[model samples]
Target: MSSDFYTTSILPFAGIIIKICRAYTDSQEDFEDYYQEVCLQIWRSREQFRGDSKWSTWIYRLSLNICLTLIKKKKNNRQHVVSEYQFVEDTEENQAFEDESLNQLYDAIKQLSEIDRAVILLYLEEKPNKDIAEIIGTTPNNIAVRVNRIKERLKKILDGKIN
Candidate 1:
């Protein structure tokens, strides 16, 4: 794929990259660094695209690989803790509390095995289990099974029932 093709296809997925990076990195600096690294990886791997899947699917797989690699490398050395964010403020009563819910969700996701989190993110994006499996190099049946387990585990963690 050409650079223009990669830019047009991958740039739109930057927000997803940011969300994944935020879940993996602690501080703003590390997040930015990781984000740039992801972009670089996407550029490097663009030529490997075969058009067998949607561009978004390809980008999602690329981003997941980059995030997992960075997490494994311990490249995010910052110690800051992010409190999470809300896309909107609908009411005054529980806005702050809602952010905590987001935080809890992210925390729970971060605690999952790297492959599991990638599955969850793709699932949340409404990707088919088969697509998720393809992205993570797993079987569709396995992806479905793991996703159910991950959801239940996330619920337990958010409810403070998981130690």
Candidate 2:
């Protein structure tokens, strides 16, 4: 991608890329890899964007998909390691959640299924159900129900009522 395009189109949405990548990765190395891969994919796939949805919405969907795909590939290659409840330290590159409760909530969110993780992340961003449903490829009503169920599950996870 051209520097102009990267600066104008992609850099502005780096936080969205960071958040999705951070949720899917276990360590700083993996997070950086995922972040770079998402940006690369977004740049490579720029032509595929047809303006059907807002740019941020398209970025969210693409970032989520790239993370999921990378994680799956790692798993299939037997390169994936599952660590229990390890929080990555904040770095200058990604000044991620510093609040203790936010960290705890993110830890809980990490325990969710991949789709649930994506749904909750988008929901937390305050995206409307219609927008979330469009990104997630489901009906708005399904998004509504799923959001409620995911919220309850997150609460249970955070409360230590469920693992």
Best by TM-score: 2
Candidate 2 local lDDT, residue 52: 90
Predicted candidate 2 versus true structure: per-residue lDDT over 36-126, tens digit per residue? 8999999999999999989999999999999999988998888455788755566644434667677778778899999999999998889
lDDT of 1 by residue, 1-163 (tens): 4678556866788777877777676556677888889788878887798999887778777777787777767746746656667243445432222566676677678788877788887887788998888888889999989999999988887788333
Model 1, position 102, has a per-residue lDDT of 70
Structural RMSD, model 1: 6.9
Clashing pairs in 1: none
lDDT, residue 71, model 2: 89
**What TM-score would every model get versus the actual structure?**
0.75, 0.86
Those runs of model 2 whose alpha carbons end farther than 4 Å from true positions after fitting are 79-96, 161-163
- Model 2's lDDT to the true fold? 0.87
| Candidate 1 residue-wise lDDT at 146 | 94
Give residue 147's error in model 2 in angstroms: 0.8
